[model samples]
Target: MAAAVVLAGLALRFQVPGAYRSPQPWRPEHVMGLVYPAVGAVVLRRRPRLVVAWLVWAIGLLAALQVVLQPLSRWAVAEGATGAAYLRWAAFWIYLLEFLPLITLLPLLYPGGRPPSRRWRPLLWLVCALIAVNVVFAALLPMRYTVGPLRVDNPVGVALVGELAAWRRPMEWLTVAAALGCLASLAVRFRSGGPVERRQIGWLGYVLVAVLLLGCLDMVVATPFALWIVPISLAVAGVPVAIAVAILRYRLYDIDLIVNRTLVYGALAAFTGALYFGLIGAVNLAVSGYGALAGLAGALVVGLTFQPLRLRLQRAVDRLFKVERDPYRLADRLSRTVQQARDPAAALTSALASTRQALGVGGAAVEIGDRDGGVRVHGDGDTADLPQEIPLRWHGATVGRLLLPPGRHDARLAGLLARHLADVAHAVRLTADLQASRERILSTREEERRRLRRDLHDGLGPTLAALALSLDAARLRLSTDPASVSESLASLRERMIATIGDIRELVYGLRPPALDNLGLEGALRALADDLPEPRVDVVVEDADVAGELPAAAEVAAYRIVQEALSNARRHADARQITVRLRRETHGLTLVVADDGVGLPMTADGRVPRAGVGLGSMRERAAELGGSCTIGPRPGGGTEVVARLPLSSARGAPAT
Candidate 1:
């Protein structure tokens, strides 16, 4: 089905004049007469009811061709084989007039939606029937042309041309009125139509008006020797070509763009040609035929002055066509505004406002990721309906989209603005990423400093104090009596053990060796061994989380559990602590629960912030792109549950 439609559409565009040998006495120069109705038949087959009225009109036209023109051509040829026969047959010509109705009905059959109502069908049929019968009767009894005997010889020829010429004025007025009616009907339908329908119908109107103007020019201004006839040929081919694009490619203004470009280049070519001819002509007139040397010098001068000439020509063309200026300057201004912006809000505001201004749109907006992991629109105060959202990309990743509402009046400008706005979004996102990265680095530095301070005060300070006490005891014993050295050695041994314990604590505080040597489960077990009052019971289940965790992830989880236990010991005042490490289908999970004195609360009854340890634990979880929650256990103490997402970490290395 798709292939057939494609072929039919191609056949319409693929015109080859004199390709078919017609059974009729003579054929028109163009093969469009055979192709147009064949394509129309395809449309009718697809949408019978929608084009029933059009088909009625088309059948009436074919009927007129057979009934009226065929008989006249037969009679004309029967008279004699002379050039007069050509004029006689041409007088009853109805081929060109049939195209107006065909073009009007073409789009109707392949409309953007369902067909028009049956209410308009009968009236359309009535018009076609009247025109059909009128042409037939007019052909049967031709009227007189010139006043008396001036019409002498070819009476039938003069009569047909004269009568047709006489009716031209009224017919033109009728054509204009009918076209206006059709346009008004389409406009009314368009207001209530969808976006596709509106665009389609709008292009149809352009074609319709083009058709009307074409018919008028052919009937009114086209003298046999005048050059106005050129436009008549262009109108016939151009209008259908426009409609074909609208139907197949769904591009309506592409034809207009081509036409405009053609006009531009055509004007430039004509100017160059005129300059070449005029330069040569003037040189000949001045010197009674100048030498080739003079012509060569003039050509060289024109070549050297080409840039300036081109610029002047461009300005003239812009003035004549009223072309829109490029918005590169506006884009540059927007970039500067974004660079100088003080905050995310300000940058977004400037970007959207500049986009709206440059493109002449109702409004525009920018969206970025928020702290809660969802997109939030900025600059427009509220989210309006978006016509199109063109994503901004940097390094093949989409940062944000340039959002504008649908049916923006200036589509070409709107597309251009979309690309510019995307560039601005990319720049803004890059800035945001850099600022965020800097803050993270600074915060991490401050955290490392705090950890070092805590280790020095709690571990190294006590170990040094114990070592000094042992040395001082040994020195005192040696000074008093050499025989009591054994007692002094025993006292030094005890102090030395205490110092070693302090050093070990310091080493563990810096980095737990069990995490690297044994894995997450072993390190967690060793951590549980340290708690005194709580009597920690460690449960390691399923064992999938042991070696699978990245060193950093393992370290983070171990620190989180250690902090929870420490919090339970100090604040929750818990007696028994249970640490559970388990692996699920998605990721690793850790739960540390304790039976303790519960937690302190505010007047509103939510948990109060008593220490920075809990905050630190939550921050650690967040750095790993995971979540943390601390709440009172149902019966007594507190429960800290941490869930780390493994989407990126699914079988990934530690780094």
Candidate 2:
């Protein structure tokens, strides 16, 4: 059906005899005609009952149908078909359908095709508000760009351009806001979703983003003979194809290399074009009356410089996009360009050049397992022997030792440089504690899975079987014993309700029901309400703070607060407690304090001892690149303070 519609649009453009068929403004950008609907169909099949799936497919169908509207409208006007005026008007307002769903709902409700959490509803409403504004403003104006001779004026006595000059700026801003809202929705989803779902978003996102990434050069600098048109067309068409691939996960692979090469070549084309033009301009200024000679010389110069320029650009783009992606490139050059000191090899003779540059150090080196290797020295400085060895690490995994000259080193800066040295010792440390950690994580996960399986098999399975038997028995007695049938069905209903309770328990075990039902803020308040004697008060400093938290961070925060409240109620003998959540640019700060006898200090008389509950809280924070600190409050009582970095909470390491 989609193919036929698209083909009809194409055929009508060529064959339809319209009186004023100047040209079809519909370019290959509108080629979403066939692919869009087909992809939507696949998604609907995967999620048969999802309402958003139907919306997505319907949007696709509308867009596909829109392909032929222009040619169809022109043909209708020429043939004096009824409703031709309306069809012409549709060409103008049809943009509402195409833009609204994509901006408002689809980002928040793709892949699984369900509505996002309730917190996201407001952002969607904002997008919808913008859409409504656009519709009202646009619909009031005329759309008379008919391919045929017929003049279609605005029904409201307005011009074709939709000129409410006062509202125009506001409308443009509304579009910008709508676009921002869509992006925010996508960002939130990406941050909160599981790894597989994140991958799915990535598949669709980078493809859409590539159109912008690749076109940035052309947007800023013109390409030769308007060559930007070809790539832009292909990119637009690929949007729907990428949607299909993302939904189906067909031939899914890492998109980084693809993005890198495509962007490099795309930008190189623009640069080459600019260079050619510049050369021609120079020749034209230097000589007159020999336009052909100047043109030939310019082409020759561009041809000669193109390959070398592309080679340099390829490496530059690789440096820009891919760091430590390929093992062959020198790690120094892969990270940053060498300054005007001397040769890059001489200026940054080692892999730790970036770290050296960042720290303003005299020299740095990596020593692993006493293995003797060739060292790349930078200058005549013989300070290598003056350095001391510190435990080397990469992202918290110890590899070897970092060698730094004796100085008052910054703790944070030193830790970073130590981590960067790990690639050198990665081979030897592959089977270290990392393996043990992985095994422990896997074993615990498997044990939990087994428990869930056992519960389902032993409990829910039997009840369901019993319900089926009862239904069969009731069916058999329906004609012979009508009174008994009522009694049996009543009993069956009670058993089914019990089964639902059991299922709810299992679901609750998977995730906190309160978090799912009432969001983070409400869940915290519910925890506070659960505590009666303590008079717990929950205060969330920022209104939008909870909404922006990722799912894992949300769970961690709730669990930490719950534990703190429990400890204060049971252990501290506190009569008052406060849970405060504050947002920062980098992360969130959660403080749970209670007015009671202060926590027992360790032998150091400063830090509180970490028991099971404290350890669990600390571990959760650690996993998110955050910290949990338990100590005595400034005034009195105990304070359990935690910092959760938003970048790590979002599952991205802070760079």
Task: Write down the TM-score of every candidate.
Answer: 0.40, 0.43
lDDT of 1 by residue, 577-627 (tens): 999888776567889999998777778654665346766666666666666
Model 2 agreement with the true structure over 1-655: per-residue lDDT tens digits? 8778877777877756746563544554255566667766776687677655566566666776777887787777777788877777776677677757765666667666654578777776776777777777677665455455557765553663455657779777777776766666667778888644665777667766766666676778867534766676677667656666666655333444456667778888888888888877887888867788878887898889889988888778767744333332333442444343344233333445554434434456655541112122222122445356678665675546667666554556567545545654453343332343355446656877999999989988888998999999999999999999999999999989989999999988777889978988999998888777879988889976766567777888888898888889889988899999998776788999999998876564434435667766766676666778787898899999999877554568543
TM-score of 1: 0.40
Model 2, CA-based lDDT:
0.68
Best by lDDT: 2
Model 2, position 633: C-alpha lDDT score: 90
| Model 1 segments more than 4 A misplaced | 1-29, 41-76, 79-93, 96-137, 143-235, 249-253, 277-330, 333-655
RMSD (CA, Å), candidate 1 to true, equals 20.5
Name the regions of candidate 2 deviating beyond 4 angstroms: 11-16, 20-22, 25-30, 47-56, 107-120, 136-147, 153-169, 184-206, 209-233, 289-308, 323-655
Let me know the TM-score candidate 2 reaches against the reference structure.
Answer: 0.43
Steric clash pairs (candidate 2): 393-419
Residue 297, candidate 2: how far off, in angstroms? Answer: 5.4
